[model samples]
Target: MRGTGKADVFVMLAHPVGHAKSPGIFNEIFEQKGLDSLMVPLSCRPEDFDTFWAGITAAENIRGVIISVPYKVPVYHKCAAAHDRAARVQSANSVRRQADGTWYADNFDGVGFIDGLKAGGHRIAGRRILQVGAGGAGASLTYC
Candidate 1:
């Protein structure tokens, strides 16, 4: 059974999440692993972020959140703690609830980028890499 009341919940949060892919990918992983979990995709306008975040933080059953786009930097600020990757970039691609119910942030954009390149048989060691954007995700790569 999927997404029972007792299931562990996760959220993918972005401002305009209609094109997001992580929720479907993660839900499929959970299904294949036979985990009682669900990943929900949610969106909120920038003006309503604080209210939306407060409610999300209060949902005790939500085990984690994968953040994207405009929310990454802001979500990093909301964390009680963070890994060096997130702290360095001041952006959070992912966050998990701590024992105290506070979020702990981690940004994997840089790591993921390099890993993806390596997986595709590309090397970054001797290349002049040019990242075009300067958004939250861009910060991670620039500082990674």
Candidate 2:
């Protein structure tokens, strides 16, 4: 169903993509919504990142990319534009191709966590939350 026509392709990029859950999750969501899209899991050695990214960017049908692990920051730096969340931390877990084929970056690491909390009926406005960890994901959480 994916390679049939002009479906918007999405790539989940990680060093070792074998463990990626996003492609399956997103694919399931697309199926449920009847979206003409596909999320494909892909990996390349660190050394191949630059070349891989170049090729990916050249793909006119690649509508978006979900970045993970070591490539988030790299991909963020390559974006033509970014949300404040991503700009502040210099990291991006997601990017979508712009109309001109450039990428626009954003990070939902923190937003998703808070949204999950809110969905679970946790009061964020009048309560406190404890966070631990460091690096890209940590910085994003702190910024949020």
Candidate 3:
């Protein structure tokens, strides 16, 4: 809880968010960069999504959100704009608030996955990729 009244807030919105590690990772990055920002996890069930999104949107300090799982597609539809990749996959893993107070959605899971593999010395070119599951994450990876 490194947040202060003036800190820019970012949220990881997910159902069953107890397993999420984004807050720790983003918090460290913010601290290292000397940023007055905080990323927190918000447990939002599918049914409560609308209310949660509405509340967060009205909060001036909330600058962005990382959406996950059951809310990805729904959030994508609600966004004012979406990246091509997100539109193709029909899912969004992140959203940023625009100056006009609208949110823009984007999908980065696939890119992140590939980047991680490349960082580990794995090459994707000419390699057959086999992924299990056809959920939001899988759909994003497949689209990439």
Candidate 4:
């Protein structure tokens, strides 16, 4: 059950956020799970990123944030702790605020892709996978 005043806030931060579907997807998941959480989109430009991030992190109710596009690398550096995979790739798409007020970063883009493939009955174990592109997604997929 959620209190009327404030709920745990999860934000999706992006520069050109118009195409992002994360808010709706996570909001639906929260509602279905009966969690007192809300996912919101925060559109921020490169120059305004630092200030925007600082303001959001200052909020006690902020639970986590999903970084998109150019912000992923920046957010990865901002995190107090990072998963080894994220460190290896130098990118992070997910960040969670710990109880001690520190941020933990991880990359789940590759996991999600692999999960989708498994769900579709694709076998990956002992299989040689070749991935193209050396961009963020490619780096994450290759690392995972």
Report, for all candidates in order, the number of backbone clashes. Answer: 0, 0, 0, 0
Q: Give the better candidate number (2 or 4) by lDDT.
A: 2
Rank ordering of all candidates by lDDT, starting from the highest = 1, 2, 3, 4
Candidate 2 Cα misplacement greater than 4 A, ranges: 123-130
Q: TM-score for each prediction?
A: 0.96, 0.89, 0.91, 0.87
Candidate order by decreasing TM-score:
1, 3, 2, 4
Compose the digit string of candidate 2's lDDT tens values, residues 1-144: 544588999999998888899999999998888888999999988888889999999888999999998798899989999999999999999999999889999998988887898899988886776777766778788777
Q: What's the CA RMSD for each of the models?
A: 0.9, 1.9, 1.8, 2.0
Give the clash total for candidate 2. 0
lDDT of model number 2? 0.89
lDDT of 4 at 47: 94
Q: Which candidate has the highest TM-score of all? A: 1
Candidate 1, clashing residue pairs?
Answer: none
lDDT of 1 by residue, 2-117 (tens): 89999999999997998899999999999999999999999999999999999999999999999987899999999999999999988999999999999999998988888898
Model 3 stretches astray by more than 4 angstroms: none
Better of 1 and 4 by TM-score: 1
Number of the predicted model whose lDDT against the real structure is largest: 1
Model 2 TM-score, 2 decimals: 0.89
- The C-alpha local distance difference test score for the whole of candidate 4 amounts to 0.85
